[model samples]
Every structure is written in structure tokens, then in C-alpha cells.
Target chain A: MAELARLQADFAAAILGPDADVGGLGGRVEGDGIPAPLRLNVYRNNFRQGLGTALAEIFPVVQAFVGPAFLKAALRHFVVAYPPSEPMLYGYGAGFADFLDHFPPAAQVPYVADVARVEWAMHELQNAVEEGVLTTSALPEAGRVRLSGNVRLVVSRYPVASLWMAGTGQLPPEAVNPDAGGQTAAIVLSDMEIRLLPLEGGIKTLAETLWRDEEPDAAQLVHLPALAGRGMLTDGETQA
Target chain B: MPILKRTEASAGTEIGVGLKSQHYQDVVATSPALSFFEVHAENYMMKGGAHRRWLDAVSDRYALSLHGVGMSLGSVEGLDTAHVRRFRSLVDAYDPWLISEHLAWSRTGGTYLNDLLPLPLTTETFEILVANVSTLQDAIGRQVLVENPSAYLSFVDSHIPEVDFLAGLAERTGCGLLLDVNNVFVSASNMGWDARAYLDAVPASAVGEIHLAGHALKEVNGLPLRIDDHGSAVSEEVWDLFRHLIRRVGPRPTLVEWDTDIPALPILLAEAEKAAVILAGETGRRKAAHG
Candidate 1:
């Protein structure tokens, strides 16, 4: 009975990646007329396809940017490097953007990683808690006015969000500039819809500051109305 | 002693279809007279959103069953306390008629694969399941059902048959069983076991719910492997077994689960209707006998 856990660990290692000796566990299925390696492959296929499909769902525009073939090649390496931590797949690909950044083959498509970040932020904000817009009455008393739980500030050296919007058909294809300059986009839920609002210099700093729970300075506070006007602030609480 | 009160079990009759997000509007607008709608509990494991709002509206109109895929009940370590709490929150919010998790492990050492991986039917795994089931029921303050999994291959150390293993787990933990007929057929076919005998081994009263779903056939090393992909319509063989089991166990809350390549709501409901015909008769007789 005690040997079962060891076997599971060995088996999990075998199916999860190329590492771990399947020789011991694979031998067990040999007597069943199904070779142990073949049996192990079934789970290998299931995990790859199952987690791969999930990764694809979260980073669709990234898949679009790199093309399906390249994306799948990248996923094969990503799943093994960082297997899902939990079963709720909604937020599983949070690290995928980082994975793509270091992924060798993806270097050709330099903006692929940033594109993934935008998609991940959008995926998160889409399911994030919706809140009522903060009112003027609530602003003065609050020491730090936090953005909505769904607000995500994405700063990239490329116009990744625009490319994603164009790729997903949210914006006209002509609006997308693959070589466009760096930009900051705020992924937030507005009007019950996920929106990517392009942020300027000051607004970008304010968004980042508010997201980090720090008090925005006068320079950043001056941009609050612009952000507030866009319904980005959801909670206004005075900090001690 | 059970820590929580048991929500009344679904009379183990009637047929329900899984509520997919794609079909949420239809479910709300049409309000199909389904026996109930089963949803993946993890999908609704959120603070607030359209998902919960829509589900709240739907629950008011119909019965709900919370089928969880992420608890990893069969993990060696134990049930995740946080995950269980989240599940309990949903249960409290909806007061679902049935709640279930698989008898397979999806996590080991910390990595969660998100797929129901097979567990060896050993005394060791049995004890783990019993403890996890007990902990989950106590945490949720209600009895939860454990569903049998379809295995692609058998473990060499597996000393216990799947049926007796589940029955013993139930007897020890006081948890109910969610007998998935499709799983029985898939596992039986994959491992060369008699599907009918497997059904006979399960105590009828332990079954609180039934699941019928489609499976994909794959060939591994020249041998047939039935994968419980739940992609297409229920096959003719699974329907036959479902019919045989329903007669033996009487009516149970039957759910038509189409997780992949899910067709339209009407198509899924059509499949549920087929099971409804079989259930309608047996459920009527039971109601009359009780009255």
C-alpha cells in the first residue's frame, strides 16, 4: 500500500515530461497486452491536448501572431516547463507570456510575448469582479483610490494590444501597425465589456501607481479625472 | 458525526443537460423545462460576474448540480482546504441538489494537470479517498458524491476492483456515489472487464446521480482504447448500459455531459429527452410506491 504513492510520483513524472523513469511503471502495463509506453502515451496525449487547448484559449491572438504551428511548438515546451498549478484554467496561462519571452523560436516574433500579456490581462479582467464607478463624493476622503479589480495596466515596448485588437477583429486590421512604437494599454471592464484603453504618459503612471496600492502624487492625481471619467476607479477607501 | 446538514438528494430521477456558457442566453430566454442543469463548479468559482448572475437566475428557475473537476480528492496529500471552501461557498449560494468530484487525482506534489488521471485501486488509494471524501463533506456541511473515473490502463498494484473500491469508500465515509454509466463502459472496454457485472457490484442505494456521455475510440498498440472525451453524442452501447443500470437501480438524476465540441443547446436537450423517456417511467412507479 505504501508503494502506491511512489508509483504515482513516478507515473506522473513519466507522463508530465521526458524526465523520470517510466521503465518501472511502463513495465506494469506490458502484461495487459498494451505496451507500457503506449499506455503512458495516452495520458501524455491527454495532458498535452487538454492543457494545450487551454493555453490556446487564453492566448488566442498570440496564437494568431505566431501562427498555429509555431504556437503549438511553443506550447509543447511551455506545458512541461510550467504545468498548471490548479484546475481552474481561467487564469492558467498567466506565466505563458513570460514563457514566450524566453522561448527561443518565439524570438523571431518579438512582440508575441507582449501580445500574450494583453490577452492574459483581458482574460483576467473579463472574469474579474464588476464594481460601480466611484463617485466625486467618495474621492476626497479616500487616501488611495484603487482601480477596479478588473483593471490591468499593460506596458510593452510594442503596440501589442492594437495588434491583438486587430487580430481578434475588435478593431479594423488597417489600424494595426506591426512595427508601431511602444504603448501602454489598460485592460479594464467597462459597460460590462472588456476594453483595452490606450493610456498616455501621465495616465499610465497613475494606473500603475493605483494598481500597486500606492498613493498617486499630484502629478498622477491630476490624471484621476480622466481615468475616473472612463469608469476605471471602483473602490475609494481612505488608507490609515 | 456529519458536520453539515445534507441538502435533500435529487430524487435520482429525471434527466439534465450540462449548462454551457455558449447556451446561457438560450437557457435564460427559453427556460427549457429540463430536469436540472449541471455546471462545473470551478467555472463559477468567482466573486462576481455575468456567470454567477446568469446562474443565479437559472437556479431560481431550475434545479442545479455542481460537478467539480479540480478538487483533486484522490491526491495523496489531502483535499485542498481553500478549494473545498470555494466549493462550499458555491454550494451555499445555490444549494444545489447534487455535488460531485471524481475518484481520480489531478494533482501530485503540487502540479495540477486539470485532467482526471487514473488512480490505482489499492488499499492505500481507498483510504485516501475515504479521508478526502469525509473531509470534503464536513467542509461543505453536506454529503458529496464521488464519481467513478474511466481508466485507459490498469495499474499492476491495483488489488481491488473498481466497484468494490467505490462501495467501500462510500460505506466508510458516508459519501454517495455518482455512477457514470459511460465511464463503466469505457473502463470495462479498456481493461477487459464485464460492464454488467460492474453495475451489479455497486449497491443501488449508494447511487445519488448518473452521468451519460460520449467517448472517443483510440487505438494504442493495436489494442482498442476508449477515451471518455465527451465530444460527440452518446453512443449506442453506452445507451444500452444506461438502460440496463437504470432498471437495476431505479430512477436517478441523469445528466447528459458534453464537455468538448459541445453542440447546440437543443441538440444536448434532445439527448436528455431520450434519457427522460426512460426515467419518466421508473420515477413514476417509485413516486407511486412511496405515496
Candidate 2:
């Protein structure tokens, strides 16, 4: 048991680190040029490629924003720092935006991290558990409305929704300034398609606040019907 | 957990294709006449939505096989109980004919690498695997098949050979073998072993299914290293091995897995058809010999 633990630890180090000794794995060099490290390299490549590919899928907007070559290089470093802690790759890149925030190379694109956050929110929202949301027709006009599990509210200092839309080819290409102030995106699933509803003023706060179990502010009352129409309001749990 | 009395193989002598989301609409719309559709259990672990809807529609028409890649049954830390329960839920929802996981570890110490790592064929590892398999079987209330891994290298600390390990595991845990012929070919080419010997060593009655997939060839220092990338068609070499093994073990349910660079549904169907023909030929040969 101790030997197995040590072997795995060594193997992990060898695969995760560039200069770790792989001789501990006890792999003999096959033909003349076939080095043992090269055998280990296959695992290293698989580890990087596997996680990198998953990140690429979850953060296609980020990939598109920075281009593939830059994304690949960042992913090479990201894999070592934030290796997946779960077998399922769907939720693997949750911390990727934060990783990019501190990464020095991606400093030029200040909004890259925020964009990643939005993308991650969207990704999670898509896979979030689907429960029966009350239609607007059955509105309980007297209490705090609960949001469906599929609702994600992303507030970013950049127009990430538009950037994401442009990246996904939902809209024509337009110049998006990363420094163009903040925006709130209500990422909701309507008719099984992800709709990035750009929120403003009280509605944004209401959408964000409703994600948690809280009473809507007096200012948010005007936008409650709009929220309900977007299938964000669940007509359940009347507050006493 | 009730014991799953798998008296007769639900999957008869036919081939199945790994159903990918890209080909879902076409597959559901066309309703391809394949024997069954295999889906990775992890892919459909959502609470409810389009994927589930699609799977429901497809499973209504074709037989379903739930193949899991994230169970991490061989972990020394023991099987993840939460994962087992989720897996059980999937089994309950979709009563798949066959369920299988790899004979490799992907998670340890709370970290999942998401790649199948080779396990040392030692008594300690084998004992843990038996316990893990038993726990999973009890949890899922079914017999699960364990697939042989495509190893990039071997460990000197390994006491038993892989075939012996798998055979012993099946004997102790009452599990079945998912003999991935491509893995046998890949492992043979990578570690310089006789795949035929490996196949012959496996108990024929223990094999419940077979997996055929294409492998990517990587040149490490000018020597070929067969990586199980599942990005192309099954090589002629792997096909030959599959033919030989099926003839030896007789035909179990075979699957053609293509995860990356997934071709059109028609292409996957054709690969499965090829496997079906091989299985059919084997059945015919057996009947002729019996007569």
C-alpha cells in the first residue's frame, strides 16, 4: 500500500512537473531512441490535452477572445495550477476565470477573466438541474418568488454578453471595448435555448438578489413582471 | 442491494455505437437499425433537460448500454459513495442492458485526473479492486464489466500479469470482463507484449462484452507508441485481434467507441456493422463445428 501511494505520488509529480524524475516509474527504454521519459511524456500530453480540451469546451468564448495559440499556452500553465479535482469535465473550469485574473501574460485583456466568469456561469446554468418553473400566468402576486435552478446572474465590468454573443456568432462582429463600464447579464434558459438578457438598474439587482432566497426590494417591484415573463420567477413560497 | 441475476446476456450477438450528442438528432430522426446505443454515464448525469429528452427518445427505440468513465472504482481511497449513488440513479432511470467501467484508476486523494491511469498488478491493488467492485455491484444492484486498460508503461513492482489480475478479480467479485481488443493491441504495442497471449489467458466465460476503437500512433524517440485516443477507425490489426478473440470467446456484445473527431452517424454505423458481421461469422463457424 505504501509503495502504491509512493508510485502514484511520483507519477503525478512526473506528469505534472516538467523536470521531475520519472525513473521511479521503472519503465525501461524500448528501442535505441525510445527514452523512458518519452513514454512518460505520453501521459503528460494526455493530461494536458484532456484538461485543456475540457477547458476549451467550457470556455469557448474565452478561447475565441484570446485566440487558440494564447489559450493553449495559458492552458498549459492552468493545468498544473488548477488540475481537475473531479472526473466529470463539465464543471472542471469553474476557477479558470480566477486563474486568468492573476495570470501575468493575460494582463492585456483585463476583461478576459470576467468574460470567463460569464461563460462559466452560462456553462453551469445550461447543466443546472431543471425543475418545473411556474408560468407567468399563475403568478402569486403577494410574495417573494423563487428563481429556477437554471437561472444564473452574471454582473461584469465588461459587456461580456455582447462579446460572448459576437464570439458565438449570434450577432454581427462589432468592436467591443473592454473598458466600456459594467453590465448585468441574466443568463436564463428560455425554450431550451440560453438567452443572455442584459439587465439594467433595479431588475439586475432583483435578478441577482432573487438567485438567493430573499425578498425583492421596493425598487425591484416594477421589474418583477418582466422577470416572471423571462421564466425567472417561480410562483411558489408565499412570504407571510 | 439485490443480486443481479444475469442469467442470460441481455445484449445478444450484435454491435453497438457510442452515441455522441453531435449525432443525436440524426440518430433519433433516422432511428438507425443498430443493435444498441452506448452512452457514457457521466455525459448524461444532468437532472433533466434536452440530453435526457434525447436519450429517452433514443432508448425507447434502441437498446441502451451505460458505459461509465468516471466511477474510479480502482481507487485505493475506495469507491466514491456519492458517485455510486448517482450511478445507481442513472441505472434506475435507464435500465441499460449492460454497465461497465475501466480497470484503471482516475481519481485518488480527492483529485480526479480524468484520464485512465494504469494500476499495478499487485495483490494489494487486486484486493482493493475486488472490494471496490463488490461495493459498486452492491450499490448498483447489478453485475458490472471491467475493461482492461491501455497502458503506456508497466511497473516493475507488479506481481501479477494484467490478465491474471482481471481473471482473479472476476472470480472473487463476480464481475465480468469487458475485453477491449484495441486496448490489448495498444498495450501490446506500447509495452511490447503478446496480445494473443493476453487474450488467451482471459477466461472465456468471464467476458461479457468487447470494445473496438481506433488508436492514435505517437512517435516517442522514433518508436511507435499506440495511444488510445479513439479518434479514427479501428485499425486492421485491431480488427484481426477482435476476430481472433471473438472466435475464441465466441461473440459477446461488441461496441465500436469513437469519442473524439466523431465521424458521421453513418460512419459509426458502418464500423458497428463490420463488427456485427464478424460476430455473425463467428456464430456460424461455431454452429458448423457443433454439427
Per DockQ, the best of the predicted structures is 1
The C-alpha lDDT values of all candidates are: 0.82, 0.82
Q: A228 in model 1: Cα distance from truth in Å?
A: 1.3
Q: Please state the Cα-based DockQ of model 2 relative to the true two-chain complex.
A: 0.50
Candidate 2, B94-186: lDDT as tens digits: 998888999988776777777788877889898889999999999989999999999887766677989999999999988998999999999
Report the Cα lDDT for candidate 2: 0.82
The CAPRI class of candidate 1 is medium
- On the 0 to 100 scale, the lDDT of residue A107 in model 1 is 77
* Best candidate (score: TM-score): 2
In model 2, the runs with Cα more than 4 Å from the true position are: A23-33, A134-138, A209-215, A237-240, B5-7
Angstrom error at residue A121, model 2: 2.4
Model 1, span B1-291: residue lDDT tens: 654424344555667899888898999999887878999998888776677788988899988889999998888888888888889999888988888989998887788876788888888888888888888888888888899998887877788999999999888988889999999999899889999999988999888899999999987678788899999999999888887787677888899999889898899989999888878776666557777
Which portions of model 1 miss their true places by more than 4 Å? A19-24, A136-144, A170-175, A208-220, A237-240, B3-9, B281-291
What digit string (tens of lDDT, one per residue) describes model 2 on residues A138-164? 777676577876677777888877777
